[model samples]
Target: MGHLFSNYYEAVSVILFGIGFTTLLLNRNMIKKIMGFNIMDTAIYLFLAAKGYIFNRKVPIVTGEVPTPEQYINPIPAGLVLTGIVVSVSVTAVMLSLTIRLYRRYHTLDIDEITRLVKEEK
Candidate 1:
């Protein structure tokens, strides 16, 4: 019970990931799909960062005094997550721009409608 309470973030992240997957799988709106993708990306980032974290740890840096590995938290996972967030933002921006273009052309954000219109045009 205590461990479960302590690791609630993991549980929330899993729920978010599942919701995002469901949205991605079932949603018809392009914007909603993008939002779902963002949710999934965020959940993954949260889960990874949470996994990498340690209780009662300091930042990873060597001081004048000799430091043991256990004294500091590993920086790699945090760095990776930061990079992932940047990439996700860029991807989201590009996806939104594409969605905007699609909406302008078809006057609808529905993926099915867009496909059908494209099919009719071809």
Candidate 2:
């Protein structure tokens, strides 16, 4: 039963990652692409954090009841995920800002259209 649940979680994570990757690759809108990238980052973070979580484990702390970290989930992966989330947010912000600039310069959001216009101008 536990194995089944674990497999399910892994499968779902993989599916999310694949969908996000495909969206990032196929989407033409800059905002959508950014969203897809964020989704991919989130999926990876979730996978990592989930992998660190152990069954029947308490939170990692030095409490009286749980004096040691033997039965607790590891914290390093979660911390890394937090950092990854921050980085992803920063990247998305920069990408969105660039998209806005592109929109302002070209007056269109379509990637192909913008490329054609830039080529024509050149």
Candidate 2 TM-score, C-alpha based: 0.88
User: Candidate 2 lDDT, tens digit per residue, 49-103?
Assistant: 8888898997776676736668788989988999998999898889999999999
| Weakest lDDT window of 10 consecutive positions for candidate 2 | 60-69
lDDT (Cα atoms) of all candidates against the true structure: 0.92, 0.85
The superposed Cα distance between candidate 1 and the true structure at residue 31, in angstroms, equals 0.9
Candidate 1 has its poorest 10 consecutive residues by lDDT at 66-75
Candidate 1 residue pairs in backbone clash: none
Local accuracy of candidate 1 as per-residue lDDT tens digits, 4-83:
78899898899999999888889999999999999999999999888888889988878799888988877888999999
Query: TM-score of each candidate?
Result: 0.85, 0.88
TM-score of 1: 0.85
Query: Clashes per prediction?
Result: 0, 0
